[model samples]
Target: MPETTLPRPRRLLLLSVSAGAGHGRAADALHAAAVAEHGAEALHLDVMDYVPAAFRKLYTDFYLRLVEKFPSLWAQLYRITDETPPDAAMARLRRALERLNTRSLRQAIADFAPDAIVCTHFLPAEVLAREQLRVRLHCPVHVQVTDFDLHALWVVPGLAGYFAASDEVAARMRARGLDPSRIHVCGIPIMPAFAQTLDRATCAAEAGLDPQRPILLLMGGGAGVGALDDAARSLLRIEADFQLVALAGRNEDMLARLRTLAAEHPRRLFPQGFTRTIERLMRCADLAIGKPGGLTTSECLAMGLPLLVFAPIPGQEERNCDYLLENGAGLKAVDAVALEYRVRALLADAPRLQRLRDSAVRLGRPHAARDVLRQVFANG
Candidate 1:
């Protein structure tokens, strides 16, 4: 008779950056999934936190300002970065920037010595690739492409695998010279809470929402960018009786203003300021109206909630919106007037709403977290 022992559980290091919150949140979701489903010891760190404070501040501030005020410039930079060849001057500049700015990042990776590394942002992947080239770092690395569109920056030659949000992205990676076999077609990983089924009536009541009325959930991403007030006001113009759940994340002034607006208006408006119950709120919502960031759109799809995409930032958000519209999973409205029309029309057409909902369900990868964990270990 013989007995066998299982191999030691893998320690997964999930790296992210807080540039816009989606990267860090995606890392968190993957970490939670690894621990709960695979019993893996996982650590999630914001790569920006390890970098020098001044560098972190400059990087984040520049990114926010560029995307907010100079969207066309952001789009141009995105294209330049994406199209840069490996040996081009742009590539040399990126490598130099990583070396000059990310000493702490290299140290963090060396200290952790994880069995596997998952990068939710491209910066970490590039830094790790450089470190691996310079040292004996041999841990398997996998990249979870945060957006549906595959940017060239996310592709570094030595990675073990690439997890993409859709097959189209996988194909794009292949076109960009990535090996097809190394690419996986898993959607972006989201928190497991979005996968669970909860009673809509109970969730609605807990959030102080009326179960009988149609619920429209509006958001402006984590930074609370975009015209939240105008969007809400325009949606309110709909003659149909409906409830609004406005999530003004960390924008206290917006929250206060929304509260005042709710007080002055007759329609029921639930103003929230950065709450953790987004999964619950999505469950209680008939439609999700917001900018189509990678994470927000993924969360909505995970909850089987149809999307009414508002004005998206010109680069990645625009790419994400294109994916949703192309897949028949969402509708886009570029202005307040268009937003109002989309909301009213979708509300009035039950069949169209159902079709969008079905498309969302079909496209959603509720088990994406587990799928990613499985793919990582299998490839390793």
Candidate 2:
């Protein structure tokens, strides 16, 4: 009889850009799912790390500064760029510049020789798509659109598949001339911990929160950018019987400010810095208050925690806020006053809050990471 040989496990290259935390977090989720659930070998890389220092600063620092200090301008740019045709001269020039700066990333991809590649950011996918036009890649590249909205930049040619956050986004991808069969609607991939069943009382006790009172989880995304201090103060002033858990991610100055607030409020307010245990905190919270970045909202939804979105950044975040509102999973507040009012109202209406949680449960895709790995490998 002829000898039978077993196939080797698949190797996955997960690429993300550090423009913001959501992309990297999505890649991390996929990496975890690939190795732990799918029995695949995965290597994750931040494409910005391979770019030159000058380019990296321009790409990352400039975006942060723009979105934080000049959000209106950032919004305008985002709209204009998204409206611009992919084949426009300006777009072509930008893509050329990105390709020129990312030679090292190409070399890394070549060295890894992965069976499949997944990108959580558009930048690397754009670069690889352009490279594929010149030289065919050995592995199929799949892009996971981390936001509920799909920008024109994310609609690159020569990609094997796209993982969308919603059916709406998938429709938009098809409208942009992508093959309908290539789009997969698997909500934004979040950490596997969010998928696990956690006891609210246990999580609350671990975080030094009272499980009896309604806990409101506040965040300002990974960079801790937003009117978090103002929003926190306003929410804390509310007369409702609720506690607040504020997460100041990767912002020491913000953390210090939050700690001061915590001291003033005592046990009423809990301040946290950047943490890998956000799933734990979400598990304890009755509501989430903050900008609705893709990953944060996904985590909240996974935990069946309703969101009170405040001042979402005007581009994708605004679009995300719209998605939540349309889906009955969240409410939006245009300012501090609105935020306080909405929180107070929701606190007073237990049934309404529960309804929001129900909606979130329906929308949440806790197993999206595993689904992505399954589909990517199944097709590969």
Candidate 3:
């Protein structure tokens, strides 16, 4: 008889955190896909939860505040570490950050002992890369870049593969001297739900919104921003005769504040707080008004809804906005005044709005999530 081996289900570990909502959600969708394909027993952990409380606060909360509130510092740090064109000096800092993060990361690896480690955050990826170089790890480690462009922090030296959101990101990686063979432009890892299109009027009506008027959906990253209030006032000040749906993400205070402002204009404004029904809301909207986080950009593209980007973070989001602008996938609002003008200009011209919608549709890969599934399953 021919030699035969039983099909084995590899134990996979998905490592991520809730720094922003995007990273955790991407990991969740990927893990669900892997479990459905591999088995229900696969393990996943938000690495923030794996560490001590003090460490979690530093990694998850404090880091985000520093990046958002004092972006210049972060930019300056990036320039120092990543502007060197992939030299030894840059690698030293990269590995230094790895070692700093490894105190808890090593523990997680020891406990999980996974056949494969899929990281949605850079911290875990760096630790794994350093471990591979220092010690012999029997399994492979993959990092999924959860943005339209990557930061040097995410660039691990010895990764088995990189899952990128777009071709522009892949090209940028090549510019950074990464091997083209190691990068896979898998699009952003979104839920399969984004693939199913819903009728515009039906979705709008179902969401208790107006189908006849232009619908503007405003959001910040999960941390939320002061920009929404400024944008809302500007949208009204410009006499925008439209229905507005503003999603104040996880900012209960901002949501409450917006609700108070929205009360002054009942028919035109609708503000929501930390909604889980994002896909439904996206289907109902005419335009996505937010920062171009990788997952949000991908979801918007798949929905064929155009974008109006405002207040993009200085690093990855700026790169994302540039990509969208370069490709005519979206428009940028440099400030509240500029944002108002753009909104009025776009909404007034039906043909131009339609053109943007068409561009968004053309840029979309509805099967991106499925393509990722195919690649992961085939390779695994």
Candidate 4:
């Protein structure tokens, strides 16, 4: 009998943008899962890095500034963009500008020659789709929608497939004329750590939290744009027997303020800076109070931690909150008072909290990253 040899692992190219944390995190999750679980060679790149400095700053910084300083205005822009047809004159002009700025990305993609390409952000997918219109791409290109909502910008015409965060998003893609077979609703991909079975007591002890008391985890998104200090102070004032863990991600000023508050509250409040052990802290949490960013929400759900969304930014975060509320996995608080009230109520009502946790566990897709990899490489 002739000897049989195994096939080489598939090469994957995962592209994302630095406009915000969720997309990059999603790409990173897919990359980690591909290499660790499937033994595939993976390369991840920030699309902004291939563009000109001026464009990169304008693209990323402008979005951050808009979302932080003028959320209402950002919301308006988001609505307008979402409502605009992809083939509209303004949309075409914007896509043309994006393609012009991302010429170098084409060369980078050609150099890698990946067997499959997955984009967690729409920009790289749009660029590649345009390139395919001009020249044939040998590899399959798929766009993963990181948010629960699908925007028109993500509906690029020429692509192999789309990975949606939910079935609703997949339906939106279908309404946009996408082939049903190409849309995969696999939830948002999260880090493998979230899928692990971690002991809550051990995790709580690691974070210096008491497992005997309820733990409320509060966080802004990666940039830490929320007024976490005020929220923490409000949460501290609640007449409850629970610990609050506030994570200020990469925001030095917010972290300092949090530490100062922790000093005042002593063992009751814990302030954390950007940490890689988020999965552990999440495991310790009884409830999470944060803006429902896609990746963060997915992480919370994966951990079976119920969310209490606070003043979600008007577009995607708001939609994400709605999804949680509809699915009974989370609650929403439109103001600080509401947030405090909701937290107090949920903590006081143990059965309700347990129900929320049960719903979250039911909705969680811990193996979404692996599912994505398997689906994309099934034929390969």
Candidate 5:
């Protein structure tokens, strides 16, 4: 057989770790976007699979422990990184990464020589930026800041562009000396599934929720850490006839606990474990109660679901909560009792919920994945 010399197929590698479900979710969205543009044959890799098992375990476990057990320490660490100037720490971290476990990463990048690199998480982005420093890898490094705020970790020394989650984030990047041209102001990337699903009535019925009662969907991302029990308690105090669907997200214990408490009032509350059908759930929901994780917020916005913020982490989540509150996409709670008051007021006032729905729909960029693909492929 004649050797076909049409050049090896161009590939796009999606580098992400399961540090949290949010990062992997973003990677999945970007990978789908890339594949939509270049075809599935050109797609390769799930970075979580490429790293050493022990290191992967450590990476995921450390973050889980920090968020679960010692959130104050996590907050302090986040604030320290958050306050670092763009010029100082990113470069320092870039240089410090010369000794990273780049054997697999480098070979993958070298073999694929990907037309571009899209990063949904910070660590892989840092590793790639430093790999460029170490070996001068030629592809453009496109960093997708998966949250609504800018973290210093996302500010790689030589990134070609940042597809930010919001305009507020773009402004912060500019303040730190990033050129406007390098910022795309693209809303956070979401799974094409979100873009495709459009069955509000059907989803509501299937979830065993009332079509007439105002529906509250509660979540706290993958770890399921929030004042959920308190939030549910507040909802009950509000005297809302609303049906609630609480996503307890990998917190099996939390889900089980909620299940037992909620069984007495099955018509009023539903507690679910880690789920992939969030897009469907969001469409059926009337309001949301949770911390504002970026991807979760994005999915909620895409469905025009208003949020009621109860317990946002001190750093990124605080920033997300600010964005929603500033834009009227949601409201914040001062504490458990106060949170209940807010829920009662909002749920009782149909006009207020409608206005929030309008705000959320306005804030949503359903075609963000298209914009990301356009930017990435336009370079190649």
Candidate 6:
């Protein structure tokens, strides 16, 4: 019998935009997963980095202001866009934007010559679709829908595959005229660190926390934009003897506010800023309190950590919150009073917390990165 030669590893180009932490982080996770799972050569590129600085700033600032200062307007825009299919005007505008902002991206893709291109953000998908039309790039192009909800903006004509975070999202994509065979419900790809088993007590001790005490990790994603101060204060009102690890990411003002609150209240509150050891902290935490962004929720689900979400931004985050609540993986609170009550009630009820944890474990897809890679290289 002839010896069978192993196929060469595929080169993956994982693209995302830095509009928010979730999309960029998802790209990075997929990149890392590819390398770890198949020893593949992968380039994780931020499409915004290739665009002009002014354009990048315009995009990021518009998103921050729209979601933070004018959520209602953002929600309205989201609804309008979701309801309306892409028209000639929309295609023209998209093409103009592609020409203006994606020259560098196109150059990078040409130089890399990847075997597979996976986009975690919609902008890259648009650029890739336009590029495909301009020139016949033969590599398979895949889009990872980061949120549980589906939007029309993510639908591109030339995409080879769609990796959805949930079955609901897959169904939504199908309803929007996508071929059912092209969409894979692979869940959201998270970092490989979250998939590794860690001793909870050891992780807690390393973080200078008591191993016997229950731990609650609070965060507002990488921007630290959620109501952490209010959540902390609300949590203080409860009489539980648990430790709070609040990751006030990149927001010095918010970190200062948390520090001051920690001082005044004098509980076991660990306030930190923009950490990379979130997986370790998640391992130590019994539950998480934060805004339910897609990536954050996926990370929590992977860790089997229950969530107490508050005030999810109106579009995708709100839909993620609804899914969590519907699936029993989390509970939501809209205000300070509600936060206090939910925290106290969940903590006091051990059975309920355990049930939520069970649900989270069931919903988690720790091997999503590998699963996505298998699909990308299934034919090869």
RMSD of each: 2.2, 1.7, 3.0, 1.7, 2.8, 2.5
For each candidate in the order shown, give its overall lDDT on alpha carbons. Answer: 0.87, 0.90, 0.78, 0.91, 0.78, 0.87
Give the clashing residue pairs of candidate 1, or none.
Answer: none
For model 1, what is the error of residue 249's alpha carbon versus the real structure, in angstroms, after optimal superposition? 1.1
Per-residue lDDT tens digits for candidate 6, residues 1-380, read 99999987779999998877889888888888888878889999988879988888888878888999999999998898777757767756855876688788888888998999999988888777767786757788999999889888898766889999998999999888888889899999898988999999889988888878888998878878876887787787789899999999999999999999889856578888998989999999999998898999999999999988888899999999998999999999888889889888888999999999999999998878888888987844
Give the residue spans of candidate 4 off by over 4 A: 1-7
Candidate 2, lDDT over the whole model: 0.90
Model 5 per-residue lDDT tens digits across residues 138-167 = 788788888889887777657777888888
Task: Give the clashing pairs for model 3.
Answer: none
lDDT of 4 by residue, 13-122 (tens): 99999998999999999999999988999999999989999999999999988888899999999999999987789988988889899888888888988999999988
The better-scoring model by lDDT among 2 and 3 is 2
Worst-scoring 10-residue span by lDDT in model 1: 261-270
Worst 10 residues of 5 by lDDT: 94-103
Query: How much is 279 displaced in model 2, in angstroms?
Result: 0.9
lDDT of 2 by residue, 190-296 (tens): 98998999999999999999999999999887777775777789999998788999888888999899888889998788888888888889988999999888988
Q: For candidate 5, what is the lDDT?
A: 0.78
TM-score of each: 0.96, 0.96, 0.90, 0.97, 0.90, 0.95
How large an RMSD does model 2 have?
1.7
Candidate 4's error at 27, in angstroms? 0.5
Greater lDDT among 4 and 6 belongs to: 4
